[model samples]
Target: MQTSVIISTYNSPLWLQKVLWGYFAQDRHDFELVIADDGSSDETREMLAAMAPNSPVPIAHVWQPDEGFQKCRILNKAIAVAQGERILLTDGDCVPRRDFVEVHTRLAQPDRFLTGGYFKLPPNVSKALTQDDIAGQQAFNAFWLMRHGLPFTSKLLKVVATSPFDEWLNRLSPARPTWNGHSASCLRSQAIQINGFNEDMQYGGLDVEFGLRLRHVGIEPRHIRYSAIALHLHHGHGYVTQGMKERSHGVKENTRHNRLTWAERGLSQWLDSSNRATLLRDDRLTRF
Candidate 1:
């Protein structure tokens, strides 16, 4: 089945370049990539334009005007135009391993959503990563990462394991499987059924909130944390505040308490908005 990989990006073109390279190096190439841009400058547009021509798969850019943190809004827009049966959500700052796409595709089930995890890199290592490293698939190597400054830890096993070992690690992992923005996938129908993300959220636990809604609707969350890996590039979280976290906490609590499946301010609301047509007809999305 065709998959649309939706990557949310802001103003980090340099990190985005690496993320795109990671996709380019994927073992599977049957997927299209949709970039859900939350109002970045012209630089990001130009970068995508320059890189799109050589991409192995189709690429589309869905951008919204910058009005603080409206990730859910832009993501909803991206989901509206995505022409795939399944959608994989991630961030531009996370570089996937070569087998990432294949793993997600193979593990996908009709009644479940897949959630993966990322191995974070420090600022120095994040900056040190090159396109060659990602394309060659060495960036995911534990020794290569250690050589480039990642400290040794048992977590590195997530980077080195193959086959049965990875599967065992995934089962043993304590981290709960949720709709992680860094690495997650679900059916397009499933996402649309509950109306996409909650626009009421602003960065803190928003992904978890979406997952809670999916769970409410009887979609099981499956763990692919060890098998589908991504390397998270370091960046500042200036947008995150205690207030945002508190507000998101409340929204999640409301979801659990009320068993709310539909989002009040999500995809359906965006589609019914007055400007939906204009946004869909814009030149930002590329057919190639």
Candidate 2:
């Protein structure tokens, strides 16, 4: 089946370039790339425009004004024009492995949704050199394996080797990945039929909520462990200190599409907001 990969990008031009190149290097060439430029201020759009004409696959860009960091809006918008049975979604800052698309295609099934893998740096990454995205990915991968390998393998790895619904999953197979679905790909219709992502989110918590929603909707997840690796360019610390915390404990600074409402409605709306940058400082809007 034809696959359409949806990338929601902001100001990460360099990372986006690598991701596109990786996708181009894929063994399979039957996919299209759809990107939603959530109003980037950098040379990202220009770079994408210049590169699209000569790209190995069909490249399309849907750009909007500098709204807040509304990833859901862009994803929803891109999916409308996308033409593919399977949809792969990844962050612009992460570079997909050459086999990224191939592994998903081979394992794809009708009732099952794929929960690909991702590796993020430890909480201490902020103190270290988090500037290099690729470096960070490597560091995170090693750290990720050390911490959760046993539990992850015993609990969830088998799904990747064989679909649980498929009899083979019960055979002696390793566990699939548990933590990287943001970089994971899914069937286009499965994602949309579940209403895609919660458009109310901008960043951070969106993925977590999405996982919960997918489970509630009875979506069977196929995990990818060994294949579909990617190099994630560093973007510094996250908005929240820990995944559960609402506010960041570190110094507040200007981030790409940085806004005050990040903890509130999410960076999604703020990035697309007209006065998104200025209005975020408004204390009356704090939901947390």
lDDT (10s digit) by residue, model 2, range 142-171:
444445332343333322333343334323
Steric collisions counted per model: 0, 20
Error of 1 at 42 (Å): 0.2
Please report, as a residue range, the 10-residue window in candidate 1 with the lowest summed lDDT.
274-283
Q: lDDT (CA) for every model shown?
A: 0.89, 0.55
Write model 1 residue lDDT over 1-288, tens digit each, in one string: 389999999999999999999999999899999999998999999999999988999998888878888888889989887878899999999999999889989999999999999998999999999999999988988889999888999888879889999889889989988889899999988988898999998877789989999999999999988899999999998987888888888888898799999998888754645324235434265556
Best by lDDT: 1
List the candidates' TM-scores in order.
Answer: 0.95, 0.63
Candidate 1 residue pairs in clash (backbone atoms < 3 Å) = none
